[model samples]
Target: MTAWDQVLELLGSPLMQRALLAAVLVGAAAPVVGTFLVQRRMALLGDGIGHVALTGVALGWLVGSWAGLVPQDTLALPGAVVAAVVGSIVIELVRERGRTSGDLALALMFYGGIAGGVLLIKLAGGTNANLISYLFGSISTVSTADLWWTAALAVLVLGVGVGLRTALFAVSHDEEFARASGLPVRLLSMLVATIAALTVTIAMRVVGLLLVSALMIVPVAIAQLFARSFNRTMTLASVIGVVVSVAGLVLTYWQDIPPGATIVVLAIGVYAVAATLQPVLRRPPPPQDPHPDMVDDVLLVDDVDDADGATVRRPSPTT
Candidate 1:
């Protein structure tokens, strides 16, 4: 079959349909929450949360194996989500304590999370393939249940993002000012962090732990290059994200490449193009005033003191 035929065939299949839908939902939701992260300069926060989520996945597998409560794979989702959310909240709490810089706290969490996840995975006897799937994603293996769960979480992310857009922008721009203005700055920050954690977990299914942050941040970066305002950035980033996600999935299907990596590569390509054109596309500086001080004066002139000690007011530079 030709490439287009294969694409059509795959689109007709239930598995491919689920994968595409999941990608769209992730594309739409990730950049929305991600815009706030980018604005707040917390771009790596998602990656850190993703690292912590690996431990949750391993723990879920172990608990499910021992307790027989659910399928190990099924349990991993909630486990990862819970772990990520808790990890994010802890990060916030640490930031509030004022003992460490936010970057330092995130870096510590990043290393600790990966270390804990590796240990848990080894203890759980998870196969290398299972570990790889979590790290890099296996979109072909995304089950129907996974699709619904991802969709639900995506909706929640979008809902929370839209409902609190103003508050989020206020806190993101200036927390001290927001606080002084009676905006629950701490509470909003925590809420945004928690929502970001959830976004990372959901995005992990489509882009994997290693590249989830790329999906969350790259689109926003690209949008910022061309967008004029925060809302415009969010909207344009969402569009860019969906385009890249769909294009990546289609290309992966055609070339038999890794979906997560392909998606990230596509996003990077978009960023590269945007970055390249940013300077060329920027608006030129407005024309300068010839006599900036002349606005308050009835007559515009440059005074010159001659040898006679008398002031001669000549017309300004423009004249």
Candidate 2:
């Protein structure tokens, strides 16, 4: 096939359609919440929650494979959501009780959960079929059910995200001040955690748990270098994500590289280029401070007048 035909053929494939849809939807939801996640210095929270999704995927596999309650392919999501919620609550509890930082607590939780998942996999005789998918995502393995789940999750996440935009803004900027201003900062934090967890779960199906967090964070990180407002950040991040997703899929199809890894590499490339170009594309400065101390002598001189009413002020000299 010619190169153009090959590209067109891949786009027409059912698996490609499903994979692109999942990537686009998850990409949209991820960076929207990620804007806040990055600002709050909780980028690792995405990693932690992505790890938490592994527990869900394992449990889902176990239940479907062993208990026959749900199909094997369907196991990953429920387990991910439950584990994510638990991880969020645990992070909060650890902060309140142990006085530990959220990062420390999340690190502990992620390692502990991974250890537990390994033990569980060993106990189940370590089937390579289900385990490999968690390590490296398979776009071909994504089912219609998984696509529907992702779409539903995307809608729910975006709804909460849009409705509580202000509360999230407040919490991201200043938790104490948000609470003082009568915003439900604690509740909003939970809401944000829940959304993050949900997005992590859905995105895992597209990118796998190991690299899914990168999809959530890297795109937004790149967009922030150029985006002037919160809205612009989300838009640019989504656009970058979509472009990378499509390009990654094409590269994966041609080179037989893992799609998830290709996606992350493309995202990193975008960030690297943006970072390099940021110096040349400086944003307009924020509004200047109103205080007189901040005003330059030249500017202050412009504000003053000489006895003759000229704008320029004469400097005093001493003999």
Candidate 3:
């Protein structure tokens, strides 16, 4: 069969359909929250939440094994979601209460989260291999239930992140001013963290926990190469996120590579290319009409008519 034929056959399958849908949902959703996180100088926040969510995965497995509830992995979704949200809130609270020690707190929390996840999963009778899937994602294994959960969570994240763009922007840009202006700065801050947590979980199935921050940050960086305004940057980043994600997924099918890694690598590649070409792609300022006052301390000769009908104002280059 031809390569296109094989590609068509692959896309026709139920598994590919679901994977594509999930990838699209995650790709579109991640940057919505990421934009806010980037603005808040919390780019690594998604990675921390992802680490904490691993513990939730283990909790779900433990509960399922004990209660004969859905398969050990079935509850991983809700478990991860709850864990991420709680972890995000905890970090936000810590940063608020321990301003001088915030970096120490985040580092402690980050390492603790990873260690907790590993230990908890081991106790649940799972091995390193099981966590590997969550760590790096197993896109091929995203079930129908995961699809529904991803869709619901992605919608919630996109809705909240975009709907409250103005408020979030205000909070991210100037917290003290926002509070003085009657915006709930504290609540908004926590909400940003919560939204980032949700985004981390939402991407878990497609990009894995470890590499989630790349998807959240790199796209914004790529967009910022050209975008001058915050809203434009977010919108363009969302578009770049989806394009790179979907393109990476398609490449996985074509090349038989790891989806999460492929997605992230593609994002980085695009960024590299964009960064290289940014200077070339940038438009030079439009030539302005030269006026005498455009230069400071220039003694102008009144409109001197040269040979041509044009009047010329001579400029002194000296400051």
Candidate closest to the true structure, highest lDDT: 3
On the 0 to 100 scale, the lDDT of residue 22 in model 3 is 91
Query: Residue 84 in candidate 2 has what lDDT?
Result: 83
Residues 1-319, candidate 2: write the lDDT tens digits. Answer: 7988987898899988898888888878888778778877788787887776676667666766676554564556787789887787677566545445767888887897676666666555456566667766777677898899889999998888777777798888887798789887777878888888888888776777788778888989998888788778877887787788778877877697888888888899888988998888886666655453653444465446676866665453320
What is the per-residue lDDT of model 1 for residues 1-319, given as tens digits with 9 covering 90 to 100? 8978876798898888989998999999999999999988889889989989988888887777767664556678888999999999988787778835888999988888878887877776666577778889888888888888889999999998988898899999988899899988889989988999898888888899878999989999999888889999999999999999988987877697999999999999889988998899898876887456666456433355455767666655555
Give the Cα lDDT of each candidate: 0.86, 0.77, 0.87
For candidate 3, the per-residue lDDT at 211 reads: 92
Worst 10 residues of 1 by lDDT: 296-305
Clash count of each predicted structure: 0, 3, 0
Q: Which regions of candidate 3 are displaced past 4 Å?
A: 1-4, 286-319
TM-scores for the candidates: 0.91, 0.85, 0.89
lDDT of 3 by residue, 184-210 (tens): 889999999998999899899899999
Candidate maximizing TM-score: 1
Model 3 TM-score, 2 decimals? 0.89
The C-alpha RMSD of each candidate to the native structure, in angstroms, is 2.8, 5.0, 4.8
Flag regions of model 2 displaced more than 4 Å. Answer: 1-4, 69-73, 96-100, 283-319
Q: Sort the candidates on lDDT, descending order.
A: 3, 1, 2
In candidate 3, which residue pairs get closer than 3 Å at backbone N, Cα or C atoms, i.e. clash? none
